[model samples]
Target: MTASFAAPRYIVDGGTEATSVLRRLARAGWTTREGFALPENTWDVSGTRLVLFGRVADADTAELAVLAAARGAGVVAIADAGSDVGRALYADLARVGPVSVDPDAPVAGESDEPASSGPQLAPEQRALLERLAGGETIAAAAAAEFLSLRTANRRIAEAREVLGVRTTREAVLAYLRIRRETREG
Candidate 1:
């Protein structure tokens, strides 16, 4: 069997305490990327895990954080120290509110709680989505995946649930959006 591994999740932040934190993280073997300096108090984190930075800016930044998390890129916001504001920020990233993390906690995390917050498509779901995107009919897509029509519908239903959509078209669009985001990254 072939093995597949995900892309590295990145950690980025800025603050007075950030330099030490970044150093600690680097020493811990986490991948680090550059962004706002610590005193600037801005964090731009992305990868395939649970992390985020909130509104030092606006909705666009928040949306991007959410998208990154949804795409499975980690988004731990070390700059904010998981405060009231930080919990609030994580809540926004989670889209559910009141999500909390210990400020002093060592930075290993992944959120399996919220569906939309970190939805990952199963391989079959992805195949179906890709097939649909390619304009294949459901029966043809089912054949392509070697699944029965009923099983295919079930798979599509699961994808729709994970993507927080009510329709197959929206699921396809959401999957496509995820594909684009990961590719861009």
Candidate 2:
């Protein structure tokens, strides 16, 4: 058998508030040595696993984020609904493709591709989802795992971002589906 090589995929993100978002997400295991910077031009993202835009400052930046996501084929746009910049960035991303702004909605357009092609789940994230699948509440799961509520919710959010789903229920279902398929294949 011949060995095959595939280039490594990394996460590329930007925006005024991108650093903090990157910090939280980095803890979940998406490695990025190319740190967050203000998005000035549309970056080449076809090699990236994810393109994240957090609180873009202007319409141009928002457009750039969408462009990068389109090329990269995966994206996560984070913004506050109450803030103008957040609303603008979210709106721009939504216009081009489905963006997950609400907690219960499908985030970042997971429908664009198969979940199998997405990133592998972190151990903690997978553990949480497994517990939820077994019918435990997130709060209870968190307590059982000895994780704080904030940390648990953050993990759930990170799982959603990685699995390209929204809401803990959806994350649980996705986790189960992925596991089942992987085992069968």
Candidate 3:
């Protein structure tokens, strides 16, 4: 039987940057809807083909994006591309599958540390560490890397020990520092 697909719905925010991005999506043929407030449940989303576009400015909006993506909708936040909220949303979505980002999007922050006066990571550990540095939670990073949460946590703990750190955040920062140093050297 031929599969039936629902028409995709676009959710846009009221902010200027978000609005500009919405206009771009509209010009590209997406029918847009205003996301005035986040829905309380996934059923409130209304459309099977949902695309949440704009900046997720608050926790509720981020929750809405997560709900939408959990229900198999495509969610794109174009405005807050480099902020913590953006990264959190991206990490949440990345847990389910690959999501798209604007090509010119800025990373949340930049680092300027010098390179590997530090211990090295194995390839798998490095992969997980990089994901964590990119704003992913330990569980989410593990999911992205196709590892069990337990395994990911173990690897993270091991990495922290190797890097002489005591927390996941420290491990991520340390890894990013090394990466920057390697890149700049």
Candidate 4:
């Protein structure tokens, strides 16, 4: 996947403030990184990266100006009107190391190809469906085998196809019919 530029950082001091900022950013079509702001504290960190800081106090703005120059480092700090840590964070980031911004990559997960070509059910899958019909929740069945909910749903869907049914209720009835026939035989 192609890389998109870094999103701006926002560290508000409260939920209402954060929501307001996010709303404004959304209206402007600016994307955001995930982070939360608490009362008296604001954090705009994302995925192990600290982006920026802001404050309501600060007589001088030179410290902030210098940090802005290092914007390309993918990190920045601004001390609020009278905050000491803001200056310390800027100083620490300035000398501690270099920050290189890399493009975001796509997440790799299980491919969505059909598990198999046709409507065949393994013995394990059949038993799972039976248990589900016997009052077991899908979550329980899935957890018992460590399979994902989607995988379990897929297995049940495959069973429905094999039994020529359109719904799980029909699938259960069909399965029961087949079982009764086999027992009599």
**Candidate that scores best on lDDT:** 3
Judging by TM-score, tell me the better candidate of 3 and 4: 3
List residue ranges in candidate 1 displaced over 4 A.
Answer: 1-117
Which has the higher TM-score value, candidate number 2 or candidate number 3?
Answer: 3
**Could you tell me the lDDT of residue 43 within candidate 3?**
46
lDDT of 2 at 151: 77
How well does candidate 1 match the true structure in TM-score terms?
0.39
RMSD of 3: 12.0
Each prediction's whole-model lDDT (CA): 0.54, 0.55, 0.59, 0.44
Residue pair clashes in candidate 2: none
Ranked by TM-score, the better of candidates 1 and 2 is 1
Can you give the lDDT of residue 63 in candidate 4?
42
Candidate closer to the true structure by TM-score (higher is better), 1 or 4? 1
Which stretches in model 4 have alpha-carbon errors above 4 Å? 1-120
* Top candidate when judged by TM-score against the true structure: 3
Per-residue alpha-carbon lDDT of candidate 1 for residues 161-183, written as tens digits (9 for 90 to 100): 98999999999999999988877
TM-score of 2: 0.38
Off by over 4 Å in 2: 1-117
Supply the global lDDT for candidate 3. Answer: 0.59
- TM-scores of all predicted structures: 0.39, 0.38, 0.40, 0.34
The TM-score that candidate 3 achieves is: 0.40
